[model samples]
Target: MSSDPGEPARRALERARQSIQKIHQAAIRHRDPSLHEIADEMSEVALILGHDAGPVQDWRPCPVCGAEPGSHCIQRPGHEMVNGMHPERSRL
Candidate 1:
């Protein structure tokens, strides 16, 4: 299915949240609590999804350093464009 750039990222975030919720429910059913680990995993997933989403609003924080927005955090440059290709074109 074709989707806008932001659409796919949002979908990924939704999927990650759904997966986390399922894990929570499974934990409850199995009587084995691993909520902390589940939460950590969710956070990691969300962070990755957010990065993939790109700069929607503004550069909030340095994803690597977790520094506050507007702080002098080192920013990793986005992917370089291939010759004759538009900036939005995906290499994938």
Candidate 2:
């Protein structure tokens, strides 16, 4: 038995990656918007669990706040910057 405490989490992370790949494939095959969304959510969750998880990538624009990559998310009707990144933007 592995004495490393992180081993279980590592294994789980690998399994999650495999599951995400399967979900992505099914989403592509069915052309279902809901499936695609689910797959995306699963991928985000997996990334959160993975060891490489880090601060949000700033290369893509946010869908909710319309915050462009490398820019802060501004509150609606105002130019003030939000304290933190939008939840949608934080996801993978």
Task: Give the number of the best model, judged by lDDT.
Answer: 2
Q: Supply the TM-score for candidate 2.
A: 0.47
Give lDDT: candidate 2, residue 36: 48
For residues 1-92, could you state the per-residue lDDT of candidate 2 as single tens digits?
A: 99999999888767766665565456556655465467566656756665542344243357777865556665664433345655566556
Point out the worst 10-residue segment of candidate 1 by lDDT.
Answer: 53-62
TM-score of each: 0.41, 0.47
Stretch of 10 with least lDDT, candidate 2: 51-60
lDDT of 2: 0.58
- Looking at model 2, residue 52 earns an lDDT score of 42
Error of 1 at 49 (Å): 7.7
Model 1 local distance difference test score: 0.44
Mind giving the per-residue lDDT tens digits that candidate 1 earns over 1-92?
A: 77576888678767766665555455545655465245445555656655332221111323444433223443335633234222332111
CA lDDT of 51 in candidate 1? 38
